[model samples]
Target: MTTPLTSTQQAILAYALEHTDGRIEWFPASLKGGARKKVLYSLCRHALIQPSGDNWQITPAGYEAMGRPCPAQKSVPAKPHTRQNSKQAQVIAMLSMPEGTTIPQICIATGWQAHSVRGMLSGVFKKKLGLTIVSVKTDAGDRSYRIA
Candidate 1:
């Protein structure tokens, strides 16, 4: 037996499931602050939603609760190398290196300030493209980043 979801949780889950094929991106603007947090926390606790990078994606259990068929699973291919000449593309290329890339290296390559580089990493890559970025500190005390 399973517990029933509250009306708020149902609404949040429904809204999230409605976006795209299975992933949820646009959280309703109407859900603000504590109310939103409570709903999201409840869903996560019930395994109805899981974090995918910076976004929330529905789980198989979530589909079951919603009475919808889960989307068929597909193997995700490796992220392809970005060959464009744009600065953001170049930054991504640098991060894709086996040794990963440092903030200083990315800044030097893209002629961007450190803040701009950080913004791109968090905003464009994580939020927009849903890329998982891993950051590590080396013995040399320099931080490196790569797509994980």
Candidate 2:
């Protein structure tokens, strides 16, 4: 189920739909700094908008939430599965190892920053793929993860 948007979020999405044609580039005067970041973040976390190079573009779900029609675009069939040798696959391989893997190790392997790697683990691996990932903290204080 789609979570109801706060007033700030509603304003942001509605503006994107009506004015910017689904590009989120405006905010209220009071929405600034960390508060602005938080609004953008909640919108993204809810799958209402997504990164589009330099901009945040509203998604189909965002339109639905706003009770608006999605603009027509060229239809491109989406890939059904990740390619075997893609970075995502590589990370999955690392996680599948019996010994598990560490975030730092995954970051080193994929050239992704720690937060990006962590986001991938939760958003892609767990939520989307429905994988049960288990984490353990070694006595030495390092955290490791594995597919359980």
Candidate 3:
């Protein structure tokens, strides 16, 4: 089934389609960062956009939505999802330790504050990432986390 883009998504698609042959750069003055990501996510989910390393590009659907002609080589610039800046990856690695690390351990390993670590754990697990956390009894405290 095909999904329709939201107005914001449509705008993002339009902007991207308009510059298929060139780089599309936007800043807060043009499109706020948070709004930009929301639109990007929507476009990506419908296959209307794809990341090319660090930039975004319009997919065929995105072009059609914009009533624009598609390029012979259809492609979109997308930001790569890397584990280097991924909280989930960091948490998963810390949870793998034999000692059964604590939240503090995760925070230290990821260079995130205790609250940030806790917030990410709550938001991502069993939700966005479809992972679950398992709590293990430890001398330090109840080290809660997901193990693969």
Candidate 4:
């Protein structure tokens, strides 16, 4: 016997079943922040889904619960192109350099504030693009970042 699913869990499972081959790439707009985490945790705890890379994949029990056949695995899609003249592109280019790039340099080049640059490094570069960022501290008390 399978555990019952809440409406939110059902919806998440349905979306994953219908839209994706198996990967839960598109999370519903209504599920956000901690609420989203809680739902995902519940699903995983119930053996309904498991993490796959940054996304989730439904388990066999999940299919039984959903009364749907498991879909075949799909090829991972390519990343979308970033605008060449965009600040993100500039930052990526700067980080790709041999010397790497400092926050101040990125700020100077993009006219962004210090915090904004840091946010871009964390949010856009690391989280969104899934880029591995390495930070090194210099003798001058400056931090340099490179995509590793």
lDDT of 4 by residue, 30-122 (tens): 878999889889989998889888889889889989998766666899878779998788889999987798998998999999999999999
Weakest ten-residue segment in model 3 by summed lDDT: 19-28
lDDT of 2 by residue, 1-148 (tens): 7679999999988888889889999999998899999999999999999999999999998988888877899799986878999999999999999889999999999999999999999999999999999999977799999999
lDDT of 3 by residue, 14-122 (tens): 5555554523444235667677777667667777777777886666766776677777874788865757657676677776665556887787777889888778777
lDDT at 147 for candidate 1?
89
Query: What's the number of clashes in each of the models?
Result: 0, 0, 7, 0
Candidates by lDDT, descending order: 2, 4, 1, 3
Q: Which stretches of candidate 1 lie over 4 Å from their true place?
A: 77-148
**TM-scores for every candidate against the unseen true structure:** 0.47, 0.49, 0.39, 0.49
Deviation from truth (RMSD, Å), model 2: 13.2
Total residue pair clashes for candidate 3: 7
Predict model 2's lDDT versus the native: 0.92
lDDT of 2 at 76: 100
Name the weakest run of 10 consecutive residues (lDDT summed) in model 1: 19-28
- Candidate 1: give the clashing pairs: none
